[model samples]
Target: MTDVRSELVADPVGEPREVAPTTRDVTGLDELVVRCTACPRLVAWREEVARVKRAAFRAETYWGRPVPGFGPPDAALAVVGLAPAAHGANRTGRMFTGDRSGDVLYRAMYDVGLASQPAVTGPGDGMRLHGARITAPVRCAPPANKPTPAERDTCRPWMARELALLRPTLRVVLALGGFGWQAVLPVLDEEVWQVPRPRPKFGHRAHAVLPATDGGPDLHLLGSYHVSQQNTFTGKLTPAMLREVLHQAKDLAGLS
Candidate 1:
């Protein structure tokens, strides 16, 4: 069998922090993201997980590289999550794919007409997001689903550039989990909107509207508990609750 890691493209010349700012569009930024090897720890962990096959996925080849955002370039709404999952996105090469958390997230998105399918089994599963994109603060799946502060900082530039490129039509951002909410504030403040003093706190259904630095329409920021198993299995984040937030975000984004 061929080594999956060998099939991955060599890392680009510069680091993510340096290259991300120079990227002009989402496509270029995504290409850089997939080629990133900036975080040594994350690189080792993701590749390690991909090698040590999960029992159910033992026969499958894993996509150990960083996963890029999923959806259209001109999406009006964006969903931000903490990071890719080790057994999930790390294996499938798509955010929120092949996991229980994704099961809940895509279902809610589909219910609100943001997704073409209700669930994703893997990449090329015919799933599509309509007028909405899903991304994360960290592209690679971190160990124990927790990325170190350093890793998060190193990965921030990619998302910063993504939001900057999306600023033309992107209106509302739905952040899943407190980590994602906190991580996105600086991206908004530095790239497009001027975040308020004593930055907005995060909670399920919490909302904040940030005025644009360039005098454009305001961007709405919405928060929700992550669709992790701990939250969903415990009913902390229910289907009804998630759909409600999606509906409000869609309205704010003017995506009917």
Candidate 2:
């Protein structure tokens, strides 16, 4: 377990594409992702948020580095999110942990039998995903939670490599928002599966079947409104709505 970060300090901007392709497994990929500094804006923003400290989290230390995906390597279902929340995953160092959005998302996942608990307080709270994995297109939190298209493209290699490594058992991808949906398509089309000629549109409950290019089972892509506070508080994405989508994803992934 060498400190890969040391190897990356020399050329932070080109590390993702350079390091991602060489990772042979999810564990290795996660290690590399946590060390990425490919986007200068993202790196600075994530670290600044960690330093400022939210009022309630002031006493606690923040995990300012890029957050990596969380779950078993052999997961059958993959959950793709936009990116780590400045005060959420960026604080806890785990996707969807220590945040309201995670509370909503995990509740639905628990109800659908994909999660071991209904809430995740932080990284070591014993929460776990069964036959599922959670990740994001961008590894670091961005200013205003909106990553520029260039930043998104720069971060694409990480997600692409992650999904490529998961191709053996991954059956269904549950995109948590339009951004996640758009981010995942090119990865599937160019790296793992054969996307349809006319790419599928993004909408809650939107579904698409991507034929596997390596002779594996077809991959199912399911879209859902992000479980962000804006959506949940406004009733745009209800708990029941998310549960329905999770249930559908589970069945499609052969987890149910």
Candidate 3:
């Protein structure tokens, strides 16, 4: 893949802008999530899917509920993903769980001491991310795994609000794919997350160092290929490779 460059310190919107984190909108995150009914269609779809899938899958009864955010209440690294999977995180109400994708990601995280366990079926599964949190570009499951730009926009405020809440402690943002990366870039200070690449380009192992408006280079951005099923099956990503990236990340931020 080619290296995609962004003109640092510009608004994430394709056009130049003064503000960032346009995706994040609300505050009081945990409470806000419980009351989130912003996407009525998604709510109905999940409930309906649960009803039908229940009878069809007696042994694996549906969780039949809204998805909840995961990880500790406070974290330094935020892992942003594309969206929930119909049978995976969306069903389990925890990001990346109940799916092969989580299999790879959690295992890798465990190896690096980021997680205490290698499994995350949902809340209270005894899984913990000692230093991180996981979020999605779009909170709800989209039809056919493709979020229309409008749907993506609707979810942006939720994400933006979350970022604002975390501004005090967050040191790094890890984007799992190209879409996740784009979704986050918009919310950052223009001087930090700039774009010079053409639209719709996916990058791997990319890192950006941002200078803070508060007079420090505190925030760091890192990109990685998602631990998607396709990537695992094709050996596109491996444990050693991911470990190297984590080491580099820790080094970049002087974590270790």
Candidate 4:
């Protein structure tokens, strides 16, 4: 695993209060995100969870820091999630890994040909995604899986930069929940696409299209219920339902 500190760059001047503008390429930005401690609450909670490892993972080392987006830079689709899970990404160092939520998501993606594996045990587990990238609105795991509005706003610049870097090839965005749906709108506005005057509401299969700037291309946005236990366990979101959404997104993105 890479050392987050060793990959850090000196703090740049005139950057936003919390989220810094990306001065390097996507790879550099990934490293930069893992080193961020913009929100004191998130930093404290993530570290606390790592230090007090769950009984099952007591013998395992935790990533503890911010989890960066994963997948190819040229991906045509992006799956945006909420914050990391305390015992999940906060422990595994990869978003949507080492948890039930990730289990459901990866399985669906793999079935739809977006992922090479149906499960990811850790960062180096050799699981990969094709034509799609996985990321979150907030990089760090928040307390009780919830981040305050101020924390979300403070962390906006990173998501903004990540989306900007992916803009060239990105054609579709799959927001896993309302939180992610809301998070992406403003970020997209700052990038190549602009949200409508009255934002589209989030719902299962909710769809919206924003024409690219200067007649570049049209971007599609879709929504789905988060793959949390609350949704999956209660049948609010099922495997078939999720797979349907993913298949549609893959087709829309024109992935083979």
Candidate 5:
């Protein structure tokens, strides 16, 4: 993967901008993410979606850019998702905000005492997370909510950097969906956590214990079905099920 700074930053209209790479701080990474235009298809699609606004949000401005991870920087737990929804995080500039998926996810976290509020309507809704953080494998809102393999690979370095920043304090990772499960393994491996041979398959409540290494803390990986409408509406994943997984994570992370 290339350095995040080498990746081109897209202008609002999908044009590349002239900018230097930044330092590896939470603030710098946040700025770098919104500026990323590394994937041409993602850049064009995200900009188009923003331009042709959703009817419900026509009067509002769209973020139409990469959505940065949100939560405590030194959190003990990290909840990862596939990517931003076209009308969710892309519209609100916060991961999982302004969507049914987020509504379900945050509510479950709140039930497990990880979140302060059950509803996450937007970035300014006063929603707060304690002891846990939420992020995604991909930052941009891909067309039809699916990012290509190339795009996923291209976007991996950002997630890698994110996990590296969180490695010191991060004790457990809750991966939502198979995409997030697959996405997190490589990042964990790069951080020197000993992943088992013949990798663990993703399933509801799938578990893997990555032992501590090189002074880094031991890491716990847990899997759950995504909070997408397709899954929730069809009853593939329910609130109680999601809350149970979060409760397990909270206990393992030693969060009250």
Candidate 6:
């Protein structure tokens, strides 16, 4: 099978500290993640979300702006989630921003020493991350927070481009849920991933050892149930479980 959506890897560039603010690294999906207007329906939904949430939580105004992938400028670990949460990253622009999901993620990141701050309100909230980054399969907010398969496919290339930037040092990836892993696995080396498991079943804490390709870095990809309210409130994903995953990630990256 085709690997990691190879179509866009042709002209992949070096990991630059400064990407164009208005445009993403490439003119492909990465670029589109920042400027895409294909899903008008979701855009409208995001706007409404921002408006109401902004009014209610005036102090914590929703980001409601273009959600940008985040991490230390040169992080090695990239955590991929399904999509932006409506009141979270979709509004705040930063992955996992503005809501409970982010609260859990940032807390976990902090507990395991990955986050610069314990909570994320928006991009300007003065928080930062180290040795790790976070992104999603889709950049835009989807209706009812679900991206259609075509939408996810359209957004995959940008993620690939982002992954390309970490090139030599991207030692590990933590896929938040099944979809996030499925979207990313193909573009990477097969040996990097453990054999695929049945779909719809999330493998929390599982890990795959990936050898470098084309002289790229070796990688360790781990799995985690998304720390969404669904998982957290239901007690499927706990703070300790999430922290343990981060601890594994740090160990894998030799970050300690």
Q: What TM-score does model 4 achieve against the real structure?
A: 0.92
TM-score of each: 0.96, 0.94, 0.79, 0.92, 0.91, 0.79
Give the top-scoring candidate (TM-score): 1
On residues 1-256, what C-alpha lDDT tens digit does candidate 1 reach at each position?
1122323547443577788889888998888889887787788888889989699999999999999999999999999999999999999999999889999999999999999988789877899899999999999999899999988998999898998899999999999999999999998998869898889999999999999979888999999999999999999999999999999999999998
Q: What is the C-alpha lDDT profile of model 4 across 1-256, one tens digit per residue?
A: 1122322224422223334564456787787787776677787788888889899999998888888898998889999999999999989988899999999999999999999998889878899999999999898889988999988987888888877788778899999999999999988887778788799999999999987885677899999999999999999999999999999899889996
Q: Model 3 compared with the native: what TM-score? A: 0.79
User: Backbone clashes per model, in order?
Assistant: 0, 0, 20, 0, 0, 10
Q: Per-residue lDDT for 242 in model 3?
A: 75
CA lDDT scores, all candidates in order? 0.90, 0.89, 0.65, 0.86, 0.83, 0.70
**Model 3 backbone overlap count:** 20
RMSD (CA, angstroms), candidate 1: 3.1
Off by over 4 Å in 5: 1-22
Residue 24 of candidate 6: its Cα lDDT? 36
* Candidate 1: segments with Cα more than 4 A from true spot: 1-9
Ranking by lDDT: 1, 2, 4, 5, 6, 3
Model 2, residue 237: distance off in Å is 0.8
Q: lDDT by residue for model 3 over 120-156, one digit each (tens)?
A: 6666788988767888867666656677776676667
lDDT of 2 at 161: 91
Model 2 scores a TM of: 0.94
lDDT of 2 by residue, 54-150 (tens): 9999999899888889999999999999999999998999999889999999889999999998888997799989999999998889999999998
